[model samples]
Target: MGLCLLISCGESGKRTSVDPGTDTQDISSEESKPVNTPGKKTIVFFGNSLTAGMGLEPEESFPARVQEKIDSLDMDYKVVNAGISGETTAGGESRISWLMRDRVDIFVLELGANDGLRGIPLSETRENLQAIIDTVKNHYPDVKIVLAGMQIPPNMGPEYTAEFREIFPDLARANQAYLIPFLLEDVAGIPELNQADGIHPTVEGQRKVAQNVWEILKPIL
Candidate 1:
């Protein structure tokens, strides 16, 4: 796959072929505008900047796009963008409780990309992700989960990259959750789909991402 350049970019500071570091600020509090409707269920997109729509407007993000699709179909569900730029699995695990306060019917997990970029231990990443999943399950036993898979360049060695890619599906299977083979799919590594940073997706790219998620998410709804 040409997804070697599909590494999630949000963490600020140094950059690399694998790490297109941008912003690592946590904005989930402001971005995750959860609307509670009496009868409507909720779909919470929990992840990093790619989920946050870093350089783009909040509505331009894939979660918002998913919301648009749901509304167009008159689905009885609202989307909550709980994405924070530059969030690692550890960070997400730490704050998972805060997000759990709201009712979550469908939970989409999109972390671990930054951990891959930072060369965090694969075991550690897996553990944190599992913990996050466990937290969500503890809060809402009936909530459905959709895990977003990610890929990184071979900068961290082919073994590391390959294993990093396997974490998502393995976890999804173990937890009996749904999986999006690769979150970026057609949008990654394509210069036209990304912004000037050549990392984060542009508006059109976000739309493609939404389609990718929809393919799997649609069946669940």
Candidate 2:
């Protein structure tokens, strides 16, 4: 697959099976609220459908898989999946404050891909992401931050696509946050890794994603 497929996959992946306008709004009001589990550290996976595991069951999502890994290690961290299908960076900026109600030990920020796909202004995307990071820092000064990098196809123009790729790392360095180079690393364009929509990852693909995340996250625990 070419770079175009990468960006195309993200665009379609964000909306999954629903209408773009209708589905990409707010994630479930219920899911937006984070519930802290007593006696456990919290890890919040915040992003769009990829984080939400759009085409799969809640347990089948990468966040859920991460939970399984933590359990095996007998770690006491709660993985909260705050992913919403079709969410954009602006949506995440607005929604993040609500999830701050509970304690968050590690925050994995995974929002920008949708904004990139929709041709949202890079400034707006960067600002929204920065705001999110700022809010997290303000709420929990000691919380660890993890930024997931995203890449889009050059359909948006080489300059735009290149800049989009730079956002995550730049934010990471600025915030001193951990960075996962690409959330969909091995799963993006592989036909078998993706679902029928050629967007969302299949079950096995999610596992690969979980591994990608785990590589960066395990040491934090």
Candidate 3:
């Protein structure tokens, strides 16, 4: 499938696109300002199905909620959901260059859950994620990164589960990026928050997930 690019305009009237090879350094430097330009901050949400807002309307996804929040605050920021269902860390790495070509102020990196679910090797997942971080850093050293963590189901066994859970924090520290303890902190495993498939979150669940992400994100934004 062709890569998808989502762009939203904030009050500042600046338009952001998802084009790989864009000058991220310029974007990152601009984001560090005490106050954002009239409408310039562009936050990209990158991940798999979870970020894609599976089972929910596009506008109802967590990224959309974040956009709404920014709008409500009248912040000069736009939130773009770049999530793809069933995406693995490897897949994300392959697309990172192109996906981030546009000017991106902040990146919410969420991946690896599908890798764990598919029983992919942890080492491979780590390498893929690390590569993504390295590339982003090389392109935009000052860009703020928020690494979202995920936990594999207990059925994955203790050894694999523990290792998978550690990847996010480890990568965040290694990359000097911010960390969100758990992407699904209050939503995962909660029957009321999940859909019939039990894997994806329902609308209510996404709200909580958005809140979980927002908690860490607000401080940086």
Q: Count of backbone clashes for each model? A: 1, 0, 6
TM per candidate comes to 0.90, 0.91, 0.82
Cα lDDT tens digits, model 2, 1-221, are 33324322234433343344653434455654567888999999998788888768878899999999999999999899888776778777877887888899999999888788878899999999999999999999999999999888777898999999999999999999999999888788788888887777889989999999999999999
Screening candidate 1 with a backbone cut-off below 3 angstroms (N, C-alpha, C), the clashing residue pairs are 10-23
Model 2 lDDT, residue 7, Cα: 25
Give the per-residue lDDT digits (tens) of candidate 1, residues 1-221: 46645444434522121133433333345446465789899999998778878778778889999999999999999898887766788877878877887789999999998899889999999999999999999999999999999998888999999999999999999999999999999887788999877788889999999999999999999
lDDT of each: 0.84, 0.83, 0.73
Per-residue C-alpha lDDT of model 3 across residues 1-221, encoded as one tens digit per residue: 11111111111111132233232323322322223344587788887667777667777788889888888887878787877555677767877876556677898899887678767899999999999888877787888999998887756688998998899999999988999998887676677777776667778988998999889998898
- Ten contiguous residues with the weakest lDDT in model 2: 1-10
Tell me the RMSD of model 1 versus the true structure. Answer: 3.9
In candidate 1 the C-alpha lDDT for residue 164 amounts to: 99
Q: Give residue 109's error in model 2 in angstroms.
A: 0.5
Which ten-residue region of model 1 has the weakest summed lDDT? Answer: 13-22
User: Candidate 1: where are CA atoms >4 Å away?
Assistant: 4-30
For model 3, where is the 10-residue window of minimal lDDT?
2-11
Residue pairs clashing in model 2 are none
Residue pairs of candidate 3 with colliding backbone atoms: 12-39, 19-101, 19-102, 20-101, 21-101, 22-101
